[model samples]
Target: MTEQDPQIVYVVDDDAAMRDSIAELVDSVGMRAETYPSAQAFLDVCKPRHPCCLVLDVRMPGMSGLTLLERLQTQGAPIPVILLTSHGDVPMAVDSMKGGAFDFVQKPYREQALLDCIQAALSLDRDRQNQRETGHRLDQCVSTLTSRERDVFDQMLAGSTSKEIARALDISPRTAEVHRRNVLRKFKVHSTKALIALFAPAPAATQRAS
Candidate 1:
Protein backbone atom coordinates (compact mmCIF):
# COMPACT_ATOMS: atom_id res chain seq x y z
CA MET A 1 0.00 0.00 0.00
CA THR A 2 1.00 3.64 -0.38
CA GLU A 3 2.62 5.49 2.53
CA GLN A 4 -0.60 7.43 3.22
CA ASP A 5 -2.69 4.23 3.21
CA PRO A 6 -4.20 3.17 6.55
CA GLN A 7 -1.75 0.54 7.79
CA ILE A 8 1.57 2.19 8.52
CA VAL A 9 3.16 2.82 11.94
CA TYR A 10 3.86 6.45 12.88
CA VAL A 11 6.30 7.31 15.67
CA VAL A 12 6.38 10.61 17.52
CA ASP A 13 8.97 11.51 20.18
CA ASP A 14 10.92 14.60 21.02
CA ASP A 15 14.22 12.82 21.59
CA ALA A 16 16.21 12.56 18.34
CA ALA A 17 18.32 9.56 19.38
CA MET A 18 15.35 7.73 20.81
CA ARG A 19 13.27 8.35 17.70
CA ASP A 20 16.04 7.13 15.42
CA SER A 21 16.69 4.02 17.47
CA ILE A 22 13.00 3.12 17.50
CA ALA A 23 12.73 3.75 13.78
CA GLU A 24 15.66 1.43 13.21
CA LEU A 25 14.00 -1.24 15.28
CA VAL A 26 10.74 -0.83 13.35
CA ASP A 27 12.64 -1.11 10.07
CA SER A 28 14.43 -4.24 11.25
CA VAL A 29 11.05 -5.82 11.87
CA GLY A 30 9.95 -5.01 8.30
CA MET A 31 7.59 -2.18 9.29
CA ARG A 32 7.87 1.40 8.09
CA ALA A 33 8.61 4.00 10.75
CA GLU A 34 8.88 7.76 10.28
CA THR A 35 10.06 9.65 13.33
CA TYR A 36 9.39 13.24 14.41
CA PRO A 37 11.46 15.36 16.81
CA SER A 38 8.45 16.83 18.58
CA ALA A 39 4.69 16.65 18.77
CA GLN A 40 4.26 19.81 16.72
CA ALA A 41 6.67 18.58 14.06
CA PHE A 42 4.73 15.33 13.86
CA LEU A 43 1.45 17.21 13.61
CA ASP A 44 2.78 19.46 10.89
CA VAL A 45 4.17 16.64 8.76
CA CYS A 46 1.75 13.80 9.39
CA LYS A 47 -1.41 13.39 7.37
CA PRO A 48 -2.03 10.23 9.48
CA ARG A 49 -4.50 8.70 7.01
CA HIS A 50 -3.93 5.18 8.25
CA PRO A 51 -4.03 2.59 11.01
CA CYS A 52 -1.22 4.03 13.15
CA CYS A 53 0.13 3.76 16.68
CA LEU A 54 2.07 6.62 18.19
CA VAL A 55 5.16 5.73 20.26
CA LEU A 56 5.16 8.89 22.34
CA ASP A 57 7.30 10.14 25.20
CA VAL A 58 5.29 11.22 28.26
CA ARG A 59 7.46 14.28 28.78
CA MET A 60 8.16 16.92 26.15
CA PRO A 61 8.92 20.64 25.91
CA GLY A 62 5.71 22.32 24.62
CA MET A 63 2.66 20.03 24.28
CA SER A 64 3.52 17.06 26.50
CA GLY A 65 2.26 13.57 25.83
CA LEU A 66 -0.99 13.88 27.78
CA THR A 67 -1.75 17.23 26.21
CA LEU A 68 -1.23 15.76 22.77
CA LEU A 69 -3.58 12.93 23.64
CA GLU A 70 -6.28 15.41 24.63
CA ARG A 71 -5.76 17.33 21.40
CA LEU A 72 -6.14 14.12 19.44
CA GLN A 73 -9.41 13.41 21.23
CA THR A 74 -10.77 16.82 20.27
CA GLN A 75 -9.81 16.16 16.63
CA GLY A 76 -11.38 12.67 16.75
CA ALA A 77 -8.19 10.95 15.62
CA PRO A 78 -8.48 7.18 16.15
CA ILE A 79 -4.71 6.60 16.16
CA PRO A 80 -3.77 4.34 19.04
CA VAL A 81 -1.02 5.66 21.32
CA ILE A 82 1.61 3.82 23.37
CA LEU A 83 3.08 6.21 25.93
CA LEU A 84 6.70 5.89 27.06
CA THR A 85 7.74 7.47 30.31
CA SER A 86 10.39 7.56 33.06
CA HIS A 87 10.33 4.78 35.66
CA GLY A 88 8.87 7.05 38.36
CA ASP A 89 6.11 8.25 36.00
CA VAL A 90 3.82 5.34 36.71
CA PRO A 91 1.00 7.66 37.75
CA MET A 92 1.16 9.53 34.46
CA ALA A 93 1.12 6.26 32.56
CA VAL A 94 -1.92 5.09 34.51
CA ASP A 95 -3.69 8.37 33.85
CA SER A 96 -2.96 7.95 30.13
CA MET A 97 -4.74 4.60 30.18
CA LYS A 98 -7.70 6.16 32.00
CA GLY A 99 -7.85 8.67 29.17
CA GLY A 100 -7.94 5.88 26.54
CA ALA A 101 -4.28 5.39 25.67
CA PHE A 102 -3.69 2.03 24.00
CA ASP A 103 -0.79 1.17 26.27
CA PHE A 104 2.06 2.65 28.31
CA VAL A 105 5.62 1.71 29.21
CA GLN A 106 8.13 2.90 31.79
CA LYS A 107 11.38 4.05 30.18
CA PRO A 108 14.34 1.67 29.81
CA TYR A 109 11.77 -1.04 29.13
CA ARG A 110 12.42 -4.24 27.25
CA GLU A 111 12.53 -3.90 23.45
CA GLN A 112 10.37 -6.98 22.96
CA ALA A 113 7.68 -5.59 25.27
CA LEU A 114 7.43 -2.37 23.28
CA LEU A 115 7.39 -4.26 20.00
CA ASP A 116 4.66 -6.58 21.22
CA CYS A 117 2.51 -3.68 22.37
CA ILE A 118 2.89 -1.98 19.00
CA GLN A 119 1.68 -5.16 17.31
CA ALA A 120 -1.39 -5.26 19.55
CA ALA A 121 -2.19 -1.60 18.93
CA LEU A 122 -1.90 -2.11 15.16
CA SER A 123 -4.34 -5.02 15.34
CA LEU A 124 -6.87 -2.90 17.23
CA ASP A 125 -6.52 -0.07 14.73
CA ARG A 126 -7.28 -2.50 11.92
CA ASP A 127 -10.50 -3.55 13.66
CA ARG A 128 -11.49 0.09 14.08
CA GLN A 129 -10.93 0.66 10.35
CA ASN A 130 -13.16 -2.27 9.48
CA GLN A 131 -15.91 -1.06 11.79
CA ARG A 132 -15.75 2.40 10.23
CA GLU A 133 -15.94 0.94 6.74
CA THR A 134 -18.95 -1.23 7.54
CA GLY A 135 -20.83 1.61 9.26
CA HIS A 136 -20.21 3.98 6.36
CA ARG A 137 -21.37 1.43 3.78
CA LEU A 138 -24.49 0.64 5.80
CA ASP A 139 -25.31 4.34 6.03
CA GLN A 140 -24.99 4.73 2.26
CA CYS A 141 -27.36 1.82 1.69
CA VAL A 142 -29.87 3.30 4.13
CA SER A 143 -29.75 6.56 2.20
CA THR A 144 -31.12 4.85 -0.91
CA LEU A 145 -34.42 4.08 0.85
CA THR A 146 -37.34 6.51 0.61
CA SER A 147 -39.38 7.72 3.62
CA ARG A 148 -42.16 5.13 3.37
CA GLU A 149 -39.67 2.37 2.62
CA ARG A 150 -37.81 3.32 5.79
CA ASP A 151 -41.04 3.17 7.81
CA VAL A 152 -41.76 -0.28 6.41
CA PHE A 153 -38.17 -1.27 7.16
CA ASP A 154 -38.25 -0.07 10.78
CA GLN A 155 -41.63 -1.68 11.54
CA MET A 156 -41.24 -4.95 9.65
CA LEU A 157 -37.70 -5.53 10.78
CA ALA A 158 -38.93 -5.00 14.33
CA GLY A 159 -40.98 -8.25 13.83
CA SER A 160 -44.18 -6.84 12.40
CA THR A 161 -45.94 -8.83 9.68
CA SER A 162 -47.12 -7.34 6.42
CA LYS A 163 -50.67 -6.85 7.69
CA GLU A 164 -49.45 -5.20 10.89
CA ILE A 165 -47.19 -2.87 8.91
CA ALA A 166 -50.12 -2.01 6.64
CA ARG A 167 -52.25 -1.14 9.69
CA ALA A 168 -49.49 0.96 11.21
CA LEU A 169 -48.89 2.91 8.01
CA ASP A 170 -52.63 3.16 7.21
CA ILE A 171 -52.22 1.18 3.99
CA SER A 172 -53.30 -2.12 2.47
CA PRO A 173 -51.34 -5.34 2.94
CA ARG A 174 -50.34 -5.37 -0.74
CA THR A 175 -49.11 -1.77 -0.54
CA ALA A 176 -47.04 -2.73 2.50
CA GLU A 177 -45.46 -5.58 0.53
CA VAL A 178 -44.40 -3.08 -2.15
CA HIS A 179 -42.68 -0.89 0.43
CA ARG A 180 -41.11 -3.93 2.05
CA ARG A 181 -39.64 -5.07 -1.27
CA ASN A 182 -38.23 -1.60 -1.85
CA VAL A 183 -36.66 -1.66 1.58
CA LEU A 184 -35.15 -5.07 0.97
CA ARG A 185 -33.73 -3.94 -2.34
CA LYS A 186 -32.30 -0.81 -0.74
CA PHE A 187 -30.61 -2.92 1.91
CA LYS A 188 -29.59 -5.55 -0.66
CA VAL A 189 -31.20 -8.27 1.40
CA HIS A 190 -32.53 -11.42 -0.28
CA SER A 191 -35.37 -12.03 2.19
CA THR A 192 -37.24 -10.63 5.19
CA LYS A 193 -35.22 -12.86 7.54
CA ALA A 194 -31.98 -11.37 6.35
CA LEU A 195 -33.44 -7.87 6.64
CA ILE A 196 -34.36 -8.46 10.26
CA ALA A 197 -30.98 -9.98 11.01
CA LEU A 198 -29.27 -6.74 10.01
CA PHE A 199 -30.49 -4.87 13.07
CA ALA A 200 -30.06 -7.80 15.48
CA PRO A 201 -27.36 -6.09 17.54
CA ALA A 202 -28.31 -4.10 20.65
CA PRO A 203 -26.68 -0.87 19.49
CA ALA A 204 -28.40 -1.13 16.11
CA ALA A 205 -31.71 -1.60 17.92
CA THR A 206 -31.05 1.44 20.08
CA GLN A 207 -30.38 3.54 16.97
CA ARG A 208 -33.48 2.45 14.96
CA ALA A 209 -35.69 0.49 17.27
CA SER A 210 -39.50 0.62 17.19
Candidate 2:
Protein backbone atom coordinates (compact mmCIF):
# COMPACT_ATOMS: atom_id res chain seq x y z
CA MET A 1 0.00 0.00 0.00
CA THR A 2 1.07 3.58 -0.62
CA GLU A 3 2.07 5.86 2.26
CA GLN A 4 -0.65 8.31 1.27
CA ASP A 5 -3.17 5.55 2.01
CA PRO A 6 -1.66 2.89 4.24
CA GLN A 7 -3.44 -0.32 5.28
CA ILE A 8 -5.57 0.11 8.41
CA VAL A 9 -7.39 -2.14 10.86
CA TYR A 10 -10.20 -0.43 12.71
CA VAL A 11 -11.40 -1.81 16.06
CA VAL A 12 -14.80 -0.83 17.42
CA ASP A 13 -15.72 -2.10 20.87
CA ASP A 14 -17.20 -0.65 24.03
CA ASP A 15 -14.60 -2.41 26.18
CA ALA A 16 -11.62 -0.09 26.34
CA ALA A 17 -9.23 -2.90 27.25
CA MET A 18 -10.27 -5.02 24.31
CA ARG A 19 -9.95 -2.05 21.97
CA ASP A 20 -6.47 -1.28 23.21
CA SER A 21 -5.37 -4.90 22.93
CA ILE A 22 -6.57 -5.15 19.34
CA ALA A 23 -4.86 -1.88 18.44
CA GLU A 24 -1.63 -3.17 19.88
CA LEU A 25 -1.88 -6.42 18.00
CA VAL A 26 -2.50 -4.56 14.72
CA ASP A 27 0.48 -2.28 15.35
CA SER A 28 2.73 -5.23 16.22
CA VAL A 29 2.20 -6.49 12.69
CA GLY A 30 3.25 -3.09 11.22
CA MET A 31 -0.27 -2.01 10.13
CA ARG A 32 -1.99 1.08 11.44
CA ALA A 33 -4.89 0.68 13.86
CA GLU A 34 -7.69 2.99 14.90
CA THR A 35 -9.87 2.20 17.91
CA TYR A 36 -13.34 3.47 18.73
CA PRO A 37 -15.46 3.00 21.84
CA SER A 38 -18.69 2.61 19.91
CA ALA A 39 -20.11 2.09 16.44
CA GLN A 40 -21.40 5.68 16.34
CA ALA A 41 -17.93 7.00 17.01
CA PHE A 42 -16.57 4.92 14.18
CA LEU A 43 -19.30 6.06 11.80
CA ASP A 44 -18.82 9.71 12.71
CA VAL A 45 -15.19 9.84 11.60
CA CYS A 46 -14.41 6.82 9.47
CA LYS A 47 -13.43 7.71 5.91
CA PRO A 48 -10.87 5.16 4.85
CA ARG A 49 -8.87 5.80 1.68
CA HIS A 50 -6.77 2.69 1.98
CA PRO A 51 -7.39 -1.02 1.99
CA CYS A 52 -8.85 -1.65 5.48
CA CYS A 53 -11.06 -3.92 7.57
CA LEU A 54 -13.22 -3.43 10.63
CA VAL A 55 -13.14 -5.50 13.81
CA LEU A 56 -16.43 -4.82 15.56
CA ASP A 57 -17.81 -6.08 18.82
CA VAL A 58 -21.22 -7.69 18.43
CA ARG A 59 -22.93 -6.23 21.46
CA MET A 60 -21.95 -2.60 21.86
CA PRO A 61 -24.33 -0.37 23.82
CA GLY A 62 -25.45 2.37 21.41
CA MET A 63 -25.34 0.67 18.03
CA SER A 64 -24.48 -3.00 17.86
CA GLY A 65 -21.93 -4.45 15.45
CA LEU A 66 -24.58 -6.16 13.37
CA THR A 67 -26.51 -2.91 13.07
CA LEU A 68 -23.43 -1.11 11.88
CA LEU A 69 -22.75 -3.85 9.34
CA GLU A 70 -26.27 -3.45 7.94
CA ARG A 71 -25.88 0.31 7.81
CA LEU A 72 -22.64 -0.01 5.91
CA GLN A 73 -24.27 -2.38 3.49
CA THR A 74 -27.10 0.08 2.80
CA GLN A 75 -24.58 2.88 2.22
CA GLY A 76 -22.61 0.62 -0.14
CA ALA A 77 -19.51 0.86 1.97
CA PRO A 78 -16.97 -1.65 0.74
CA ILE A 79 -14.86 -2.19 3.85
CA PRO A 80 -14.96 -5.79 5.05
CA VAL A 81 -16.12 -6.36 8.64
CA ILE A 82 -15.10 -9.14 11.03
CA LEU A 83 -17.48 -9.48 13.95
CA LEU A 84 -16.23 -10.23 17.45
CA THR A 85 -18.72 -12.44 19.24
CA SER A 86 -19.09 -14.32 22.52
CA HIS A 87 -20.09 -18.00 22.50
CA GLY A 88 -23.74 -17.15 22.94
CA ASP A 89 -23.62 -14.72 20.00
CA VAL A 90 -22.75 -17.49 17.57
CA PRO A 91 -26.14 -17.35 15.84
CA MET A 92 -25.89 -13.61 15.37
CA ALA A 93 -22.37 -14.02 14.02
CA VAL A 94 -23.57 -16.55 11.47
CA ASP A 95 -26.34 -14.13 10.47
CA SER A 96 -23.72 -11.42 10.05
CA MET A 97 -21.83 -13.65 7.63
CA LYS A 98 -24.99 -14.04 5.56
CA GLY A 99 -25.42 -10.28 5.77
CA GLY A 100 -22.00 -9.82 4.11
CA ALA A 101 -19.57 -9.65 7.04
CA PHE A 102 -16.11 -10.88 6.12
CA ASP A 103 -15.86 -13.22 9.10
CA PHE A 104 -16.38 -13.56 12.83
CA VAL A 105 -14.08 -14.43 15.70
CA GLN A 106 -15.32 -15.73 19.03
CA LYS A 107 -14.20 -13.95 22.18
CA PRO A 108 -11.21 -15.48 23.99
CA TYR A 109 -9.96 -16.02 20.47
CA ARG A 110 -6.36 -17.00 19.77
CA GLU A 111 -4.17 -14.12 18.62
CA GLN A 112 -3.06 -15.89 15.46
CA ALA A 113 -6.62 -16.75 14.50
CA LEU A 114 -7.73 -13.13 14.67
CA LEU A 115 -4.62 -12.03 12.83
CA ASP A 116 -5.35 -14.54 10.07
CA CYS A 117 -8.85 -13.12 9.68
CA ILE A 118 -7.52 -9.57 9.58
CA GLN A 119 -5.03 -10.46 6.88
CA ALA A 120 -7.70 -12.14 4.80
CA ALA A 121 -10.04 -9.17 5.13
CA LEU A 122 -7.30 -6.76 4.15
CA SER A 123 -6.44 -8.87 1.12
CA LEU A 124 -10.07 -8.82 -0.03
CA ASP A 125 -10.25 -5.05 0.40
CA ARG A 126 -7.11 -4.60 -1.68
CA ASP A 127 -8.56 -6.70 -4.48
CA ARG A 128 -11.75 -4.64 -4.36
CA GLN A 129 -9.75 -1.41 -4.47
CA ASN A 130 -7.85 -2.57 -7.52
CA GLN A 131 -11.04 -3.56 -9.29
CA ARG A 132 -12.60 -0.18 -8.62
CA GLU A 133 -9.53 1.62 -9.91
CA THR A 134 -9.49 -0.51 -13.04
CA GLY A 135 -13.19 0.13 -13.64
CA HIS A 136 -12.64 3.88 -13.31
CA ARG A 137 -9.82 3.81 -15.84
CA LEU A 138 -11.93 1.78 -18.24
CA ASP A 139 -14.73 4.29 -17.84
CA GLN A 140 -12.35 7.08 -18.77
CA CYS A 141 -11.33 5.19 -21.87
CA VAL A 142 -14.95 4.67 -22.80
CA SER A 143 -15.65 8.37 -22.36
CA THR A 144 -13.09 9.21 -25.00
CA LEU A 145 -14.96 7.26 -27.63
CA THR A 146 -17.03 9.04 -30.25
CA SER A 147 -20.68 7.96 -30.58
CA ARG A 148 -19.84 6.01 -33.72
CA GLU A 149 -16.74 4.53 -32.13
CA ARG A 150 -18.76 3.50 -29.06
CA ASP A 151 -21.29 1.78 -31.33
CA VAL A 152 -18.42 -0.06 -33.01
CA PHE A 153 -16.97 -0.97 -29.62
CA ASP A 154 -20.27 -2.41 -28.47
CA GLN A 155 -20.62 -4.40 -31.68
CA MET A 156 -17.11 -5.76 -31.32
CA LEU A 157 -17.83 -6.82 -27.77
CA ALA A 158 -20.96 -8.52 -29.02
CA GLY A 159 -18.77 -10.58 -31.38
CA SER A 160 -19.83 -8.74 -34.51
CA THR A 161 -17.45 -8.84 -37.48
CA SER A 162 -16.38 -5.55 -39.03
CA LYS A 163 -18.49 -6.29 -42.10
CA GLU A 164 -21.46 -7.16 -39.94
CA ILE A 165 -21.09 -3.97 -37.91
CA ALA A 166 -20.96 -1.95 -41.14
CA ARG A 167 -24.20 -3.50 -42.37
CA ALA A 168 -25.90 -2.96 -39.00
CA LEU A 169 -24.87 0.70 -38.85
CA ASP A 170 -25.38 1.32 -42.57
CA ILE A 171 -21.73 2.38 -42.92
CA SER A 172 -19.15 1.23 -45.43
CA PRO A 173 -17.01 -1.70 -44.39
CA ARG A 174 -13.84 0.46 -44.59
CA THR A 175 -15.28 3.06 -42.18
CA ALA A 176 -16.39 0.34 -39.79
CA GLU A 177 -12.87 -1.15 -39.86
CA VAL A 178 -11.38 2.23 -39.02
CA HIS A 179 -13.75 2.64 -36.07
CA ARG A 180 -12.88 -0.86 -34.85
CA ARG A 181 -9.15 -0.09 -34.90
CA ASN A 182 -9.76 3.15 -33.01
CA VAL A 183 -11.76 1.32 -30.33
CA LEU A 184 -8.99 -1.25 -29.92
CA ARG A 185 -6.34 1.47 -29.68
CA LYS A 186 -8.28 3.51 -27.14
CA PHE A 187 -8.69 0.44 -24.90
CA LYS A 188 -5.01 -0.48 -25.42
CA VAL A 189 -6.00 -3.94 -26.55
CA HIS A 190 -5.00 -5.57 -29.85
CA SER A 191 -8.04 -7.81 -30.31
CA THR A 192 -11.75 -7.95 -29.53
CA LYS A 193 -11.39 -11.08 -27.39
CA ALA A 194 -8.83 -9.32 -25.21
CA LEU A 195 -11.14 -6.32 -24.94
CA ILE A 196 -14.01 -8.53 -23.81
CA ALA A 197 -11.80 -10.12 -21.20
CA LEU A 198 -10.75 -6.70 -19.96
CA PHE A 199 -14.38 -5.70 -19.46
CA ALA A 200 -15.38 -8.95 -17.77
CA PRO A 201 -16.35 -8.76 -14.14
CA ALA A 202 -13.89 -10.25 -11.68
CA PRO A 203 -14.80 -13.55 -10.09
CA ALA A 204 -16.39 -13.32 -6.67
CA ALA A 205 -13.98 -13.74 -3.79
CA THR A 206 -13.97 -17.16 -2.17
CA GLN A 207 -15.67 -17.55 1.20
CA ARG A 208 -13.42 -17.83 4.22
CA ALA A 209 -13.09 -21.32 5.68
CA SER A 210 -14.91 -22.12 8.91
Candidate 3:
Protein backbone atom coordinates (compact mmCIF):
# COMPACT_ATOMS: atom_id res chain seq x y z
CA MET A 1 0.00 0.00 0.00
CA THR A 2 1.03 3.62 -0.49
CA GLU A 3 2.11 6.03 2.21
CA GLN A 4 -1.38 7.53 2.20
CA ASP A 5 -2.94 4.26 3.25
CA PRO A 6 -4.42 3.81 6.70
CA GLN A 7 -1.64 4.17 9.24
CA ILE A 8 -1.02 1.49 11.83
CA VAL A 9 -1.20 3.28 15.18
CA TYR A 10 0.53 0.77 17.41
CA VAL A 11 -0.70 1.41 20.95
CA VAL A 12 1.42 -0.42 23.48
CA ASP A 13 0.32 -0.36 27.11
CA ASP A 14 0.61 -3.03 29.74
CA ASP A 15 -2.89 -2.15 30.88
CA ALA A 16 -5.24 -4.35 28.88
CA ALA A 17 -8.26 -2.09 29.32
CA MET A 18 -6.32 1.00 28.32
CA ARG A 19 -4.99 -0.66 25.18
CA ASP A 20 -8.46 -1.91 24.25
CA SER A 21 -9.96 1.52 24.87
CA ILE A 22 -7.43 3.20 22.61
CA ALA A 23 -7.88 0.65 19.88
CA GLU A 24 -11.62 1.15 20.04
CA LEU A 25 -11.30 4.93 20.03
CA VAL A 26 -9.12 4.97 16.94
CA ASP A 27 -11.21 2.30 15.19
CA SER A 28 -14.32 4.36 15.85
CA VAL A 29 -12.81 7.11 13.74
CA GLY A 30 -11.99 4.63 10.89
CA MET A 31 -8.27 4.30 11.59
CA ARG A 32 -6.24 1.12 12.03
CA ALA A 33 -4.94 0.17 15.45
CA GLU A 34 -2.49 -2.50 16.53
CA THR A 35 -2.22 -3.23 20.23
CA TYR A 36 0.92 -4.61 21.85
CA PRO A 37 1.66 -5.47 25.46
CA SER A 38 5.30 -4.55 25.20
CA ALA A 39 7.79 -2.63 23.06
CA GLN A 40 9.57 -5.77 21.82
CA ALA A 41 6.25 -7.26 20.71
CA PHE A 42 5.43 -4.21 18.59
CA LEU A 43 8.83 -4.22 16.93
CA ASP A 44 8.43 -7.84 15.88
CA VAL A 45 5.37 -7.57 13.60
CA CYS A 46 4.91 -3.88 12.76
CA LYS A 47 5.35 -4.01 9.02
CA PRO A 48 4.14 -3.00 5.55
CA ARG A 49 5.97 0.11 6.63
CA HIS A 50 4.10 3.05 5.27
CA PRO A 51 3.15 5.71 7.79
CA CYS A 52 2.75 4.74 11.45
CA CYS A 53 2.52 6.23 14.95
CA LEU A 54 3.11 4.71 18.34
CA VAL A 55 1.18 5.44 21.53
CA LEU A 56 3.31 3.93 24.26
CA ASP A 57 2.58 3.84 27.98
CA VAL A 58 5.22 5.18 30.35
CA ARG A 59 5.71 2.21 32.64
CA MET A 60 5.80 -1.19 31.03
CA PRO A 61 7.32 -4.19 32.80
CA GLY A 62 10.15 -5.11 30.37
CA MET A 63 11.00 -1.79 28.78
CA SER A 64 9.75 1.56 30.02
CA GLY A 65 8.05 3.81 27.45
CA LEU A 66 11.01 6.18 27.13
CA THR A 67 13.34 3.24 26.78
CA LEU A 68 11.23 2.01 23.86
CA LEU A 69 11.39 5.44 22.28
CA GLU A 70 15.16 5.48 22.53
CA ARG A 71 15.40 2.02 20.99
CA LEU A 72 13.18 3.03 18.08
CA GLN A 73 15.20 6.21 17.52
CA THR A 74 18.46 4.24 17.53
CA GLN A 75 17.05 1.70 15.08
CA GLY A 76 15.89 4.53 12.79
CA ALA A 77 12.30 3.38 13.07
CA PRO A 78 10.46 6.04 11.05
CA ILE A 79 7.18 5.80 12.96
CA PRO A 80 6.46 8.86 15.10
CA VAL A 81 5.65 8.24 18.76
CA ILE A 82 3.03 9.87 20.99
CA LEU A 83 3.93 8.68 24.46
CA LEU A 84 1.38 8.33 27.24
CA THR A 85 2.59 8.93 30.75
CA SER A 86 1.06 9.16 34.19
CA HIS A 87 0.97 12.56 35.96
CA GLY A 88 4.10 11.79 37.94
CA ASP A 89 5.98 10.84 34.77
CA VAL A 90 5.64 14.19 32.99
CA PRO A 91 9.39 14.58 33.09
CA MET A 92 9.71 11.48 30.90
CA ALA A 93 7.38 13.10 28.37
CA VAL A 94 9.75 16.04 28.09
CA ASP A 95 12.64 13.67 27.51
CA SER A 96 10.68 11.89 24.79
CA MET A 97 10.16 15.20 22.98
CA LYS A 98 13.90 15.85 23.09
CA GLY A 99 14.49 12.44 21.47
CA GLY A 100 12.43 13.27 18.34
CA ALA A 101 9.09 11.84 19.46
CA PHE A 102 6.22 13.76 17.85
CA ASP A 103 4.36 14.33 21.11
CA PHE A 104 3.44 12.81 24.46
CA VAL A 105 0.07 13.01 26.17
CA GLN A 106 -0.59 12.57 29.84
CA LYS A 107 -3.17 9.87 30.54
CA PRO A 108 -6.85 10.79 30.93
CA TYR A 109 -6.28 13.14 27.99
CA ARG A 110 -9.29 14.17 25.93
CA GLU A 111 -10.01 11.82 23.03
CA GLN A 112 -9.77 14.69 20.58
CA ALA A 113 -6.31 15.62 21.83
CA LEU A 114 -5.01 12.13 21.10
CA LEU A 115 -6.64 12.25 17.68
CA ASP A 116 -5.06 15.58 16.86
CA CYS A 117 -1.61 14.37 17.87
CA ILE A 118 -1.98 11.25 15.74
CA GLN A 119 -2.98 13.36 12.75
CA ALA A 120 0.07 15.54 13.20
CA ALA A 121 2.37 12.56 13.61
CA LEU A 122 1.09 10.90 10.44
CA SER A 123 1.56 14.13 8.47
CA LEU A 124 5.12 14.58 9.74
CA ASP A 125 6.04 11.00 8.89
CA ARG A 126 4.69 11.44 5.38
CA ASP A 127 6.79 14.57 4.92
CA ARG A 128 9.95 12.77 6.08
CA GLN A 129 9.32 9.91 3.61
CA ASN A 130 8.90 12.39 0.78
CA GLN A 131 12.19 14.10 1.61
CA ARG A 132 14.01 10.75 1.68
CA GLU A 133 12.54 9.87 -1.70
CA THR A 134 13.65 13.19 -3.18
CA GLY A 135 17.14 12.82 -1.75
CA HIS A 136 17.41 9.31 -3.24
CA ARG A 137 16.32 10.65 -6.61
CA LEU A 138 18.96 13.38 -6.54
CA ASP A 139 21.56 10.77 -5.63
CA GLN A 140 20.52 8.74 -8.69
CA CYS A 141 20.98 11.76 -10.93
CA VAL A 142 24.55 12.13 -9.68
CA SER A 143 25.28 8.64 -10.97
CA THR A 144 24.83 9.85 -14.58
CA LEU A 145 28.10 11.71 -14.74
CA THR A 146 30.86 10.65 -17.18
CA SER A 147 33.30 7.89 -16.17
CA ARG A 148 36.19 10.32 -15.81
CA GLU A 149 33.99 12.57 -13.73
CA ARG A 150 32.92 9.64 -11.54
CA ASP A 151 36.53 8.77 -10.81
CA VAL A 152 37.24 12.36 -10.01
CA PHE A 153 34.21 12.48 -7.75
CA ASP A 154 35.11 9.34 -5.77
CA GLN A 155 38.71 10.51 -5.34
CA MET A 156 37.66 14.02 -4.39
CA LEU A 157 35.26 12.59 -1.82
CA ALA A 158 38.12 10.54 -0.41
CA GLY A 159 40.28 13.69 -0.37
CA SER A 160 42.65 12.14 -2.82
CA THR A 161 45.65 14.01 -4.26
CA SER A 162 44.85 15.40 -7.72
CA LYS A 163 48.34 14.34 -8.84
CA GLU A 164 47.65 10.79 -7.63
CA ILE A 165 44.32 10.69 -9.44
CA ALA A 166 45.97 11.96 -12.65
CA ARG A 167 48.60 9.25 -12.42
CA ALA A 168 45.91 6.61 -11.81
CA LEU A 169 43.77 7.82 -14.73
CA ASP A 170 46.87 8.30 -16.91
CA ILE A 171 45.75 11.87 -17.49
CA SER A 172 47.75 15.01 -16.90
CA PRO A 173 47.63 16.41 -13.35
CA ARG A 174 46.29 19.66 -14.80
CA THR A 175 43.57 17.69 -16.63
CA ALA A 176 42.70 15.86 -13.42
CA GLU A 177 42.36 19.26 -11.75
CA VAL A 178 39.81 20.26 -14.37
CA HIS A 179 37.88 17.03 -13.82
CA ARG A 180 37.89 17.63 -10.08
CA ARG A 181 36.42 21.10 -10.61
CA ASN A 182 33.87 19.66 -13.01
CA VAL A 183 32.77 17.06 -10.45
CA LEU A 184 32.18 19.80 -7.90
CA ARG A 185 30.35 21.95 -10.44
CA LYS A 186 28.15 19.07 -11.55
CA PHE A 187 27.08 18.17 -8.03
CA LYS A 188 26.89 21.87 -6.98
CA VAL A 189 29.12 20.92 -4.06
CA HIS A 190 32.06 23.02 -2.90
CA SER A 191 33.78 20.02 -1.34
CA THR A 192 34.43 16.38 -2.23
CA LYS A 193 32.74 15.12 0.95
CA ALA A 194 29.46 16.76 -0.08
CA LEU A 195 29.61 15.12 -3.50
CA ILE A 196 30.33 11.65 -2.15
CA ALA A 197 27.89 11.91 0.71
CA LEU A 198 25.15 12.80 -1.76
CA PHE A 199 25.63 9.57 -3.71
CA ALA A 200 26.45 7.42 -0.72
CA PRO A 201 23.04 5.75 -0.53
CA ALA A 202 22.02 6.24 -4.13
CA PRO A 203 22.36 4.21 -7.33
CA ALA A 204 25.80 2.93 -8.25
CA ALA A 205 27.92 5.34 -10.29
CA THR A 206 26.92 5.43 -13.97
CA GLN A 207 30.53 5.73 -15.19
CA ARG A 208 29.35 6.50 -18.72
CA ALA A 209 31.77 8.96 -20.28
CA SER A 210 29.61 8.84 -23.43
Off by over 4 Å in 3: 1-3, 147-210
Identify the leading candidate in terms of lDDT.
Answer: 2
Cα lDDT, all candidates: 0.78, 0.91, 0.78
How would you encode candidate 3's per-residue C-alpha lDDT over 103-208 as one tens digit per residue? 7787887899889888777777666676687787677756867888887776777778789889888899999989988878876788777766766654431211
Model 2, residue pairs in steric clash:
none
Task: State which candidate, 1 or 2, has the greater TM-score.
Answer: 2
The CA lDDT at 18 in model 2 is 97
Q: Number of the top candidate by TM-score?
A: 2
Alpha-carbon error at 192 in model 2, in Å? 1.2
Candidate 1 displacement at residue 174 in angstroms: 2.5
lDDT by residue (47-130, candidate 1, tens digit) is 875567888888899988888888887899978888888977778787777676878876786788888888778777766776
What's the distance in Å from true for residue 201, model 2? 1.8
Q: How close is candidate 2 to the true structure, as a TM-score?
A: 0.93
lDDT for model 3: 0.78
Model 2: per-residue Cα lDDT over 58-109, one tens digit each: 9989899999999999999988899999999988898778889989999988
Better by lDDT, candidate 2 or 1: 2
